[model samples]
Target: MSATTPLEPAASWYAASANAAPERPPLSGEVSCDVCVVGAGFTGISAALHLAEQGLKVMVLEAACVGYGASGRNGGQIVNSYSRDMDVIEARFGARTAQALGDMAFEGNRIIRDRIADYAIDCDLRDGNLFAACNARQLKGLKEHQALWERYGNTSLELLEGDAYQREVSAEGYTGALVDHSGGHLHPLNLVLGEAAAFESLGGVIFEHSPLVSLEHGSPVVLRTAAGAIRAERVVMAGNAYLHGVLPELEGKSMPCGTQIIATEPLADDVARGLLPNGMAVEDCNYLLDYYRLTRDNRLLFGGGVNYGGEDPADIEALIRPKLLKVFPQLASVRIDYAWSGTFLMTLNRLPQFGVLNDNVYYAQGYSGHGVTCSHLAGRLISEVMRGREGRFDAFANLPHLPFPGGRLLRVPLSAVGAWYYQTRDRLGL
Candidate 1:
């Protein structure tokens, strides 16, 4: 079965309480368009939105419902930057590439905000995202993180410690936090769903439940769905982890990793305020970190525990509840209202993989758990490339991606071992 073949998304809170949307019909016959985008998630939708705005006949083929993958199931924090920060990009790829990327480090955040306002997307948009320190080691790292981001010209960060930090997240054991006032959280499913509506408003087409079964790359690429085909002047592969092995070339370029999340029953007004006085979404500084935030309706949404190989854990709550309690033990009694897993593509270097395949087929994937905003930025960049521009896109396409150190079979185990090492360091405070 295709990875995107899940008849229904996992029983996520987002699915249970998703915004009202029409059940779009699946593609049933051959069609043609200026641009054919695979996957109706954030990137594909964003790309189609931009292209359609430019008056191109854009059609998005979705394997599942809109926001059915990581776009909807994530912790919903609009965290900025790639999984590997700008400093790492500069250190390894040099000041030039890093500078190019640094310019767009926060572009994704801006794109999301603009879409929310311009399209009047009612995704319950709010602001403020925090990075908490689990140890003194991580605390000091936050200081450097601030300096690095400041170098890139973002000044919306505020560092808090002791009483200040405790007031923000009324939790235990955190030393300090760096809050990006510009970063925020939202109802992810609603966000993407709204984007799809906006895309349709601009004359774009979306065929739900139409999975790309095969691709014929050429000047005018041909994509075959189970029941139909699309002959397009250009094609964009934005499926990411859920795309699975649709394209042979993308198979070895990254590994799909699953992460789980659970939502607690809504807390009383006072109880909710006490948990997060300011309603800021948060993530930790560990190698394998925990991320959480209070939902718009006052429920605590916490998530972590990366299970490599895109396999759902036997018990999602059992895997994530302990980690959630470690940060906010007071929630131990809070009933878990929902539990589910979504896979995100993880490349070896923790950078996104963006480049051309078979000449006319352009692709972008492996957000490495930072898809929320970066995917939007990728959409703009990739759309520009399709429109005969390549300057900004090259900053990402130029990055080299090596296959997982251990080929297909051992890649999962090797990645788990590497994650274990950093997790050990986080625990030992080394």
Candidate 2:
């Protein structure tokens, strides 16, 4: 009944597929740095990489292994816009602010692609993404989205209809689709490992298995762990859902959202090409979207089936097989080889939250499912702000986010009940 319950480390295809990552020893002694980052996911690793590149003494503390958080285990869809739709942003924050946010989301996509190329990260980079329309309403929405994208001079979004959708992805479930060149997919765990390696390569210190259990804020903030501690001029809370009491003010702003995925054993290369010859990531346009892509080995890595109650259903394959079969019924016989889940934070507004509570206390979270791209962008912005350039950080900091309703005790249940309603709606086509 509690969504905050820890998710078991389900066997993930990424874990089995990625190359071995270099191991950093756990923290054992006290250390000092200009900045200390409190998570080992994309944001923390990225910030460490950027900060170290700028010649700053940075230390990153990881509660678990690098990429052990949602960054290592996600749908791997590099979306082209914010987690919340543009209309929602414009309705809440006016047209100008919404447009700027949209532009930033676009840039977030670019950041991932550029980073992969610059770092020579081999993460099975794909070049296009498809937003499939499961119903007529969604088809019309995709058209409207295409028009708006063109109005903003985003010509990368192409409206696919009729035979084109069937031809490109070899699927008949969607009424139509929107293809965005700006967005794509990659091997998420590999990307995270490569980023961590890049950060260390640039001389940043990373301490694995060093969870910060206590904090003392001042001119030089102190972060204490079981075996080690860090005293630094700046402290960044980037733990997302895995963080607890590292900072009190950050507690109620977001709820941990649990999502699951399954991957089939490799299909014949010709079979995969028959299914999706274009080699792009495909996700339906729904409240709880079913996202999937072909792995480099030609396996269908499908992700769907969300559980807000933090209880993974006993029959996860049963719960999600229907969703998969709905999209690609032709592949109903494919054997599912791996299934897993990860918790990512989600705000009520679904926009990312960023700011400094005090001068030396900086934090960013609530990226929802947009963590892959936004986390990288967060690192860039945080690095800029750390170097006395606060323009980009302030842009994201200006966005408004409301705390969840029930504080700690009831927030999970409230989120679960609300998510159930949404999932039900998704099932019933509301």
Candidate 3:
């Protein structure tokens, strides 16, 4: 591919408001490095930055521009914990195993803040995120959710019921909300763009528009692109949903799912303040949930709905508008400034996948819908393995990853059926 790859996120709100960036030159000839990181999204960039700061010659190969994938187009909420809650991990994986994971669950959020401040990145960051419940059942679940995280040592959690919740969010139909004071939200694309810049400042090189066409994961792993190749002592696969054919083993192990988001025009100051009084990002408690927050400019940015098999819906606005209105009916007359969709990897168990491949190649993926923070955690863990440490990385790497029961052809349909059932229960408050 050429150095001028067409970025798919051109239509996203983040793209329009992202910080100024320079077009990086793609590799056109053979190059070698101590570490070759594939995909310059959060995982790849984080890993490359960590290794480079350690005095390693790290080179990152990105198929598109940095943050082109889920890193750029996610809901942007810095929600801690994985897609599966800590209680779920405790129930199935045991308290000892869950305790290990729970200890690190909030570490990724810290990494993000450290990157922003240490790198002098100007991404608009706000603290606190809310888990809102639409019904009594979900509300009760939130109460238990708070207790579970508290047991895991998350001291920043507080549950608000009825009138207490109104001080934070004036949205309708919510019985209560669980607030995570430590959790937050930010301009995701700008965050990645700033982090990518930090990586480069540490003497790291990132080749934009350079896709890893093939991989020979041996002693000195060889990564081939259309115009050049890389020979490295080790390789890191951070592509996630965008890896495509590069890692065939992940075919049935995970699936890419598309999510829709829309940004509304700036609202009046009073209305903006009235909508989300405390400026905390909110996500409903449902199998398929609606997440929304006010952008720095006071525009309500709402996102919801997942299309299995990574299919973009025919109308992004049509699919998300109704959900947005349900939360804030006062925005009925607001104009949608931007609407877009992006894909993220979803594993069968909704937990991230981290392990070695081909001996010299390490991969961390399948963040499900929670890649914003977990991806950074994966990067740090992968870097530890390269620095003569494996204790923390082994915690996640040792967990079993189950492939979708059906073959690739049937996985999507089967997963869709499962989602439908759960969403149905969500609708009925079961």
Candidate 4:
């Protein structure tokens, strides 16, 4: 693959209105730390923050500015679940283990709230998330899922039926939904930036524009870049989709997928409320899901549609605008002010990948589309494992993540072929 810099976020309304982040200089001189972290997104930054909080000397290197990846470009919906269903997880791992994983998924949400309160990070935090069912099939599954939530002792979830659902959401496409009061939305970029600053204030070192070009796993790992290098007792590879070829061993275990999002110009407060009367973040129940939420400023931040292929389409706004209009035709007249794409990693099983290379080098990624909360939990788990507390890490590492069947050259193509089939099935309502 040709070497690429961080692509500028498309004319996203978030970028135009996002709060400015503090500047940090790139690494110029070689540095040694207890741990060297690659990728400055939420995962890397959160790990650095946790490690620094423990008085561990940590350094973070980024390919671009902080929050430049999916950490900043995501839909900003702070959902409280994993990308894959519980049954899928239970089928692969036993019921006990699967239930444990489900609990951790919700733990990620609490981590976000605790961090925000601890650091006083102001990112327009909101409450409530709704998983809207578009048809009877979806509604049935959602109702069953809601009951399961109650059985699990999770009382925050409420099942909204037909009339209530229609009143809560302006769209007619959904029959009903499962509302989660604990789940919410936030300004992702601001949260990422604020977390990075907090980590630095605790004596953590972060190097911007310092992409790790190579890594050598050994007794003490070495991470090399264009200008400087890091030699540490332990190395954490947190660079998700953008982590191409940095480690050959990790190549086939995960594939980089692209997801896009668009933000519309701000609407009047009343209009925004009319669009989402409950002010809850909404996501449709489908393989290729459409998720949207109203920003505190009254703009609709719509994220739907994904690409299995690596390349970003030229007409991003054109590609996503129709989906937004489909959800709320009232917004058809509102102009889309911002749009952008970011790479997200997905494993074959849609479970997060966590493991060590020869007991010294550790890596975690492939959160699929549920990284907003999972990434933070990963940092805590990884940090704990680094401290020799491996129970939580083992829960995720125990699950199997096979490499893509076709290897490097044929992997993307083969996956794309299968994905195209699933997408077709989705379109035909199969």
lDDT of 4 by residue, 107-184 (tens): 788888988999999889999899998777788988888876666556899888886786668887677888888889
**Global lDDT of each candidate:** 0.89, 0.82, 0.89, 0.83
Query: TM-scores for all candidates?
Result: 0.98, 0.94, 0.97, 0.95
Model 3 residue 139 lDDT score: 92
Better of 1 and 4 by TM-score: 1
Q: Which pairs, if any, clash in model 2? A: none
The residue ranges of model 1 lying beyond 4 angstroms of the native Cα positions read 1-4
Off by over 4 Å in 3: 1-6
| Candidate 1, residue 169: how far the Cα is off, in Å | 0.5
Q: Evaluate model 4: give its lDDT.
A: 0.83
Could you tell me how far off, in angstroms, the CA of residue 191 lies in candidate 2 after the best superposition?
Answer: 0.6
Runs off by more than 4 Å, candidate 4: 1-3, 7-10, 420-430
Ranking 1 against 2 by TM-score, winner: 1
Question: In candidate 3, what are the lDDT values of residues 154-220, reduced to their tens digit?
Answer: 8999899986888899866788999999999999999999999998888889998887778886879
lDDT of residue 35 for candidate 4 = 95
lDDT of 3: 0.89
